[model samples]
Target: MAVELALSADTVRMIVQKARAVSESLPDTYEDGHEGDLSFDTEKLENVHHHDGLAEEEHDDFSESELREIIDDLNVDEATELVAIAWIGRGDYDQGDLDLAFAEARERSTSPVSTYLLGLPLLPDYLEAGLEALNL
Candidate 1:
């Protein structure tokens, strides 16, 4: 019951859980300039790292695809709301400033929403905090 959001709080929670799984699966640090060089283990969202000498094409494997699919499945409004929640959670805006946050999220979402959101570390914590702040 996220009163201020377009999506259900439960739906947002599920999305955050999926995003957290994606974040937890990734390596702790990507080289600042070479952010594109990343890959993951064959299992679930865990043990991700750079495999030496792997081709760039090879790097776009399952874990990322799984995350993309998870986010891709959401309706446009839900996706937009999730981004807003993340922005609030990350302290980019006060809970009362949700309209501005939502506007920024939509304007900034030029890339695949999943790629953008998954790139954020601590997404789950941020989202959870935002939801609490909203008293969802």
Candidate 2:
């Protein structure tokens, strides 16, 4: 699918790296027999969750310049989804909330990647709405 926003390769790489790091640190959601049974420490998870909450509070503090720099590197669709996921990670929303958002997106035939990413954390409703607005 064509990306609505235009992002630089480096920026995209950074976003992907961050997503991977977060995914790796999270507890395994698969069954016991799954090939990768990586699990996270409960204490670490708590700490990370707490920190992520704090990060959310600071999200809006990002200067217009900083926002532009980040947004400039992403396609409109990606940027829309990424920004929402970032807000969610920052503790703006909960998993159940994201579930509702995902359901809405699926009804609209949004990108799987966008759905997957948004489903991960506390993304804002606006981000999910943006995805729904996309041609995908």
Candidate 3:
């Protein structure tokens, strides 16, 4: 089956690159297998507690803000597709479930897509994995 993305592969790659810079700039505070993890899987992004130590001021604002701007600039359809890709990468949904993931992303989104995505501990990795899964 052929899957199409509202967001281009180049754009996704750029986001992943920028997000990786942001990820590299931040301190590593996440741990694996914490109780009450909000993420879908255990080993993937792991527990949210790892992000507890990272205050807003702790991250590289320039890089993060750049990424935020890029994400925020995306149309709702593109943003929703981005979320679906991440979900696929994070194992919340399989490649064949792209449509379902997109639906869930759109239906479940309550906050800014940028805010929700940037909040993920392993955004770059997940996005990269998502790209690979989609064979883009």
Best by lDDT: 3
Runs of candidate 2 exceeding 4 Å displacement: 1-13, 16-70, 99-136
Give per-residue lDDT, candidate 2, residue 108: 39
Query: Which has the better TM-score: candidate 2, or candidate 3?
Result: 3
lDDT tens readout by residue for model 2, 34-74:
32211222232222211212223323333323433333333
Q: Which residue pairs overlap in candidate 1's backbone? A: none
Give all candidates' CA lDDT scores. Answer: 0.62, 0.37, 0.70
Model 1 lowest lDDT segment of ten: 33-42
Candidate 3: which stretches are off by over 4 Å?
25-62
Quality of model 3 by C-alpha lDDT:
0.70
Q: Among these predicted structures, which one has the highest TM-score?
A: 3
The positional error of residue 83 in candidate 3, measured at the CA in angstroms, is: 0.5
lDDT of 3 by residue, 1-136 (tens): 4478757777787778778878766644334633121222223222222222222333454477777766776766777788889888999998888989988886775566776777677988899899999988
- The candidate, 1 or 3, that scores higher on TM-score is 3
lDDT head-to-head 1 vs 2, winner: 1
lDDT of 2 at 62: 34
